[model samples]
Target chain A: MRFIHTSDWHLGRTLHNQSLLDEQAQMLETLLALIETHEVDALVIAGDIFDRSVPPAAAVSLLDAFLDKVIQQLKVSVIAIGGNHDGQERLAFGARQMARAGLYIQGPVSASISPVRVDGKHGAAFFYPIPYAEPALVRHLLEDESIQSHQDAMAALLSKVQAHNSNGLPKIVVSHCFLDGGSESDSERPLSIGGADKITPALFTPFDYAALGHLHGPQYKGAEHVRYSGSPLKYSFSEQHQNKSVTLVDMVPAKAPDIRLLPIKPQRDVRIIEGHLDTLLAQGAKDPGRDDYLMVRLLDTHAILEPMAKLRAVYPNVLHLERTGLMQERSMEGPGRERMQKSELTMFEDFFNQVQGESLSGPQKALMSDLIASLHREAGQ
Target chain B: MRFIHTSDWHLGRTLHNQSLLDEQAQMLETLLALIETHEVDALVIAGDIFDRSVPPAAAVSLLDAFLDKVIQQLKVSVIAIGGNHDGQERLAFGARQMARAGLYIQGPVSASISPVRVDGKHGAAFFYPIPYAEPALVRHLLEDESIQSHQDAMAALLSKVQAHNSNGLPKIVVSHCFLDGGSESDSERPLSIGGADKITPALFTPFDYAALGHLHGPQYKGAEHVRYSGSPLKYSFSEQHQNKSVTLVDMVPAKAPDIRLLPIKPQRDVRIIEGHLDTLLAQGAKDPGRDDYLMVRLLDTHAILEPMAKLRAVYPNVLHLERTGLMQERSMEGPGRERMQKSELTMFEDFFNQVQGESLSGPQKALMSDLIASLHREAGQ
Candidate 1:
């Protein structure tokens, strides 16, 4: 079966207090274009359909529209699961009834995990949607007190699903959980207060493909078949470098599933740029992508008055601004003081290099050493 | 067609800060039993399915379970609408898909009001689900700037539905809105911040039956065919004297709809009892429904310390406590001074009667008047 695997839309999320609903709405159009172009059989949203447990009314309306277009307009099946950010019960409202209309929405963890069957030209493949579940909830639901960690919870859940899906068909498991070795971003809310939330990818050895979520960076964990589609948008500055995409999986009975990553162009890209204040503003005027959400860093040695206000004239969407010189000095005054573990001269050299954005010349370094030595001699006297 | 028409469930509602989830769950059981015994053709919930726009997750789970039992297990169709208290889009999540499973969830006001047909032994009856719409929203949706009042909105919406249902079948209109002449209670949330939210019942003349909601009292408005089922439980102290019930409607071709009120027994009724704290505690031991939610009024003139704590020992669910003597005295000192419209001597006599819970005898009345006259003469000197 051919499927477009995506997750963590995080609808209703705001960037630097700016609403992303409009951007999200535009992104859906791109998603629809991709689905239509690729002629995708089914759309599998692993988790995080909404940014919060109780999302805004507008976000709810957006989701309803998206589902209507995909399931009814496109005549494609959709299987979505609930993420940690979602209230599973609320997410699964009318889920049972929606399933009849080719929309299988799995929410919360249950002992009996039913597989949604999707038939493609190759054959029929069974998809097990294992929604994000806390170990405590899984422990109680499965009656397995030994499920102490996310690892144990995933293992128990997979085993239970395996018991139900003994048929020799290509099995696909769609889930949302922190997998060991998967990269994380600031926006992926931590699942537990204490640690041990990561589950090893080895638990999905029996399944042919694992479409995962929760981490913002799209990557394979431990195995190629086990991968994260990542968030459709850059939810945080930490994920600015990541290229978000939707994973398309074509699974057949005989061989390894043919996986392809279709890059998605966000409505507005998240980018970080660095240069002198004047230089960056000039660059912004000429730049075609000046409207993108931006984090600008000034490299000038001297303090610039109202640097953000000056930059905003050209770069209208500058979400963040920083003078590296001032930030470095402030950071150095923090734990960096003890963390330095270097001689006073070396520390001074590092500070000078940071402020000037260049290392001191050899002659200047020697002159500074001589002055430091003379000061030491005078203090001793 | 026979339908168990109900509304204003307000699931997840709390009575005096006490969670009513268990009570709501038990009420659902009673609702299911009635549907089974009556062999209801369809279950119609007019509106106000939840107490708030965002309900607790547990409440969402309960709703899922309830819908599952009725639509899946019992194989009964359900038609529900949205009320002013509901977030229409969120409430109608997956509504389109759910419609295929015989679960028609109508949310928000729309120009095209589709009829959900429920077939019975007599014939198929079309039900126009006109969810509650603000005058502004109705004006915008219908492109009618003249829709300036609830009366105008209802008239416009009903006219639109009438255009769609010209066939000579029995027509029923299920909706949530204030109807003129309908009895109301404290629990029925006002539809508008200002007034003029009531729609005239004359607007429903085209429909054979009107299953209404928003009023907490089960009564007809202007006509017998137009009625409210009331809520399944007493949501406030003012509704303590009101009998809560579900409405059953039997409609056939060319006939006035047959309506019956199926009185619902609450899990724990809301009650207001007046007596001395000590006496009430003694009576509580013999009262079989002592566990019912209560508003206690202490008639004793003496100060009672920690009356709530004392009452809790017997009536564990005492939600409110008031000493009438103290309360009456405080109320009299306020605007009562100017609004009294009574002589001081007469006010004193009324106060004595109220405090002592008895009318003054002829001798006592004479003594009070003589004492008041003496006080007046002394003050004048």
Candidate 2:
């Protein structure tokens, strides 16, 4: 059995408040091309299909279009599961009816993890979808009081799957979880604030392949069979250096699965640069990839006049700007306990200087003094 | 051919901030029973399936459950369309894929109107769905600059359906629009603010039957074959007296369609009661349907102490309250332009007197006087 494994599409997500719908559409097109080239039997989307519980309408439309092409046009079965970011009821709305079209969506976790059987060139492969669930939900569903963390929940869930797998068929487990030892990034939300949601690598040892989501980096832990396909696009500055890719797995009866990483090229790269404003402007003027999203850190100590406007003239996609050295100095120099004893006028001047990195001009000082006098006069009336 | 016609479901609607989901679910159950008893071949939902473009998740779940019962369990075809309240793209999402399961939803207006044919005891009947469209959209789709009003848009749409009906099959046109001479209520939104959306009754002359929506009251428009099924529940107080129903239509080739109105009993009746506060309380304690949603008009001249709370003790669903005689007097005696020259203290006293329907007590008057003195003192600082 051969299949394309992808996860963390995060559709309807915005990077620096810029819509990624067009880029997401382009990436799905590339995914389709890869599927056709590899002649994959089925498509497995692990989870986090939508960025949020209630996504915008355009996101729904895009997912619908992609499913129509893959399931209806290509005649391939698709197995999708709901992640932590998904609304379980919304995702599970029409799962039963949609299954008739070869689109299987598992939104809620249950005690019996039913495996969907699909035919391939090798033999029949059983695909098990384990959607995201909390410890309380798992405990309630299994009627077990010992389940406490996400690790315990997965253990309880897998025990049921193990009990049902008496046939010893080739099995693939698709799940959305934060596996232990996976690298983290800024854009990926922590599964649990208390740091109790991580699952050990040994829990996935029984499956021929474990397609995982939630950690936005393509990697493996301990064994080659378990992997995180990662996000298709760079969602934050911290992820600028991570290589985004999807996994394709090939399996045969009584043998280890073969895996290949298919790299996806984003429409525009996310880049970060640090230098003096003048030097950065010079580089921006000559750069060929000017449309890439950029976060710039300026080393200059003094404030520049409308630096963002100047930078955007040459690099239209500059999303962020920072003067880290000067900002640190201003923070250290801010008013302390003496601020309460100082007059309002003196405090205002200090705040203005701190924000703009300069003292008030002569005319501006006069304006402030006059405004304060008027306020006092009004109070005295 | 025999079918059940219903429209303007407005699922997820609220009456005075109270959710109508339970009532809607009960009504759907009644509708399902009706379908079974009548042995209906298809279910036609003209438009307005949801109350808002972005319905709550619970509403989506309810609608999905209803569809699962009707389409998957009973094996009946469902044909729905987008109304002005629906987000067209959202409603139309997954339409092509859902059609395989005998559920059809049409959104956006176009020149090509595809008819879904269902086999019935009377031979074959073709159902043409014309979703609501603006005048501008109609003009753009048909490539006709002359389409300027909703009437023109409907005319242009019907022309296409007429051209497609050369097979001489029994045709039923399902649409969502306001027809001329139809009596409307407060709950129904005007299709167009300029009144250009009202279509003439003659537009349905070519079809064997026209199942319409948008009006809350079920009534025939000029002919027996053309009718509105009305909403299944009272959405507003204005519709409290209107009988809510679904239309059951029976048709054969080359004959006038037979229509029957099946009245639906609401979970709780919306009622209006007017009397003195004492008299209302006496009546509320004795009424059998005390749980009915009530709008009360109290005729007391003096202010009642927490009237809403008092009424709710017996009538738990009292959604609105109006102090009729005192409010009328207050409105008549409101301050006019001449009061602008009056002192703030006098204005405050008058406002308090009007709201309370009595002058300030000794302690209250002294507190107000002291508050005014403190304000003056602060200004003099």
Candidate 3:
């Protein structure tokens, strides 16, 4: 059985206020081209097809077009799941009827026993779609209710799927979650801060092929069967060097699966060039890549004037300009009062009183502090 | 074909910070009961299932449970659309797959000719799903780009649908939008100020039955076929007197849509009583409807003392207590300084110049005006 694995589309994401829907649409089209060219058995979009729970209209239209072309027009079974970025209820709204069109969507947290069976050269294969599940939702859904984190949730989910596997057909599990030992970009929302428990590789132990999403990097953890088919487009400057690609998996009985990395050409090439302002200016003057998107990390002592305008004249795709040296030098500095306060008046008042101790009277300070505290609590709540 | 047409579930909606979800869930259960009793062919939810774009986790869970009961257990063919309050892309994310299970969702602004052919004893009926289309999106999607208003947009959509009437099946159009001759309450987002210009009834000229959402009132807009199913629960105090219901639309060939209003038992009843403070207090003391939700519209000459606390004792669901007479009087007296200049400084400046002929220096005035504009914009924005 041959399949294309891709996920974490993150559609409708904007860089600052700039809409990336057009680029996202182009990337999806490129993905469709891959599907057509490879003659893939199944296309698995694991999760996070949208950037937010409430995606804009453009994102919807794009996804709709993609699904219509790939699943409906091409006659390929496309299985999608709800990622952390999706609202499960919304994602699962019309999923029941969609199954008839050979487009399977599993958006709920529950793990069903019988997978949607698909015939392959290897005889028969069962594909189980497991959407991203929160610990609390998983706990409520599972009878045992022992799951305390994402790892526990996945374990519980896997156990359910494992219990129902009577027929020895090769099984594949497509999931949208952060796997342990996988490198994540800053864009991926942290599941938990103090949990080495979250990144455990034990979650994907039950399935033959574990296609994962969430982590934008295309890599595997401890298990060779488990892999992440990274996002098609470069979303952030941090992902400038990432060779964005999809994974094609050919599964056969009692043997290792053959994996092929198919490169995806982004709408614009994303590259980071490091140099001082003078060097960067000189580089721009000589010849800057016109088509490639550039993120110039200047090692200048200060901010440059009209840097974007000057660079954009040469390289039309210069989306970001940064002073890397300044950021590095500023990183070690003491936390400013503004950073500490963060619009919290009570915290600000406390710091203010501490700094100007003699100026505030006891009663006045008490009144101000209480007022600030109440307001802060009200606003925060 | 017998079907229940209902919409605007708004599962997470709060009546002035008071949770109405429990009440809504109970009412939905009542609607489910109606579906069972009526032996409905399908359930049409036009749109606005959740109150906000990002519904709470609890709301998502509630919707999940409801869908499980309705589509999974009850075996109802549920067709829905995305409303203005809904994030269309998110709501329709997995809709392509869900459609296989007798759940059809149409979310795009384009005149997508989606028809669910439901076979019944009489014949097959085509249920056309047309979600609300904003004017701007309609202009972009329509073949004729001349559509400038909501009316024009709807006309264009209707024309498209009329052009593709291949099935010739008894068609019913399910839409989530404002229509002509509908009155909007405070809770509804204003589509247009005038009645006729909001949405012309001619938009549904091609359909045999028109099932509409948005207007939270059950009424036929001078046409037997064109009607609003209305919201299932009272969303605001303005709708306190509304008999919340699901329209049991039974369509027969060569006859008008036989619509039956099946009342839903609200978990907490919404009632708005108007009286003076003393009279209201006496009425609450005497009457014994403690369980029913109350939104007291006090007509007191002066503001009452601890009105919420006092009302909450008798009517636990005293979600709102506003002096209607006071508001009316205030409005009648014309715009106050707060409504005019919008700030104390602006009011002072206007007053000083107008009454005392006191002029400010150029720099001082400029600085003051800038500061005033900044503060006002900050507050407004």
Report fnat for all candidates as fractions from 0 to 1. 0.85, 0.56, 0.54
The digit string of per-residue lDDT tens for model 3 on B1-381 reads: 788888888878888788887887788778878877877878889888877767776787677677767777778788888787876665676566667676677766554667778765435687878887778778887656788788887777777667766466777888877776787767777655554338777778558888888888887775877888788888887787788888888887677777789888676777788887777777777676766777788875433447688777677777677779657645655375444443445445655665567765688677876777787778784
The residue-by-residue lDDT of candidate 1 on B17-111, one tens digit each, is 99999999999999999998888888999999999889888988999999989999878889999987777889999899999999999988777
Candidates sorted on TM-score, descending: 1, 2, 3
Residue B201 shift from truth in candidate 1, angstroms: 1.3
Tell me how each candidate scores on DockQ against the true complex: 0.64, 0.45, 0.27
**Tens digits of per-residue lDDT for model 2, B1-381:** 899999999988998998999999999999999988888889999888888888888988899889999988888888888888777677776677777888888877667997988876546688999998899998998899999998899998998778885477788999999999999977887888978889998998678999888888898897988889998889888888999999999986567888899989988988788889888889888898889888888887655557899899989999988889666655555475322222445557767876778888889878887787677677762
Candidate numbers, best lDDT first, in rank order: 1, 2, 3
lDDT at B380, model 2? 67
For residues A1-381, what per-residue lDDT tens digits would candidate 2 score against the true structure?
889889989999998898889889999999988888888889999899999988788898899889889988887888999888877667776676787777888988888897888886545688889999999999998889999999999988887667676377788899999988889989887888978989998999888899998888899986999988988888899998998988988986677898999999988888888888888889887898888888888886554557789789988988998877556545555475333223445657767876787898999988887777777667763
Off by over 4 Å in 1: A193-195, A328-381, B329-381
Which candidate model has the greater DockQ, 1 or 3?
1
Better of 1 and 2 by DockQ: 1
Q: Output the worst ten-in-a-row residue range by lDDT, candidate 2 chain A.
A: A336-345
- State the TM-score for model 3: 0.76
Interface CA RMSD, all predictions: 0.6, 1.5, 3.3
| Clashes (N, CA, C under 3 Å) per candidate | 0, 0, 13
Task: Tell me the tens digit of each residue's lDDT in model 3 across A116-205.
Answer: 877643356778888887788778877556777777777878877777663887778888877767887757777667753354666676
Which ranges of candidate 2 are over 4 A from the true structure? A110-112, A165-167, A324-381, B328-381
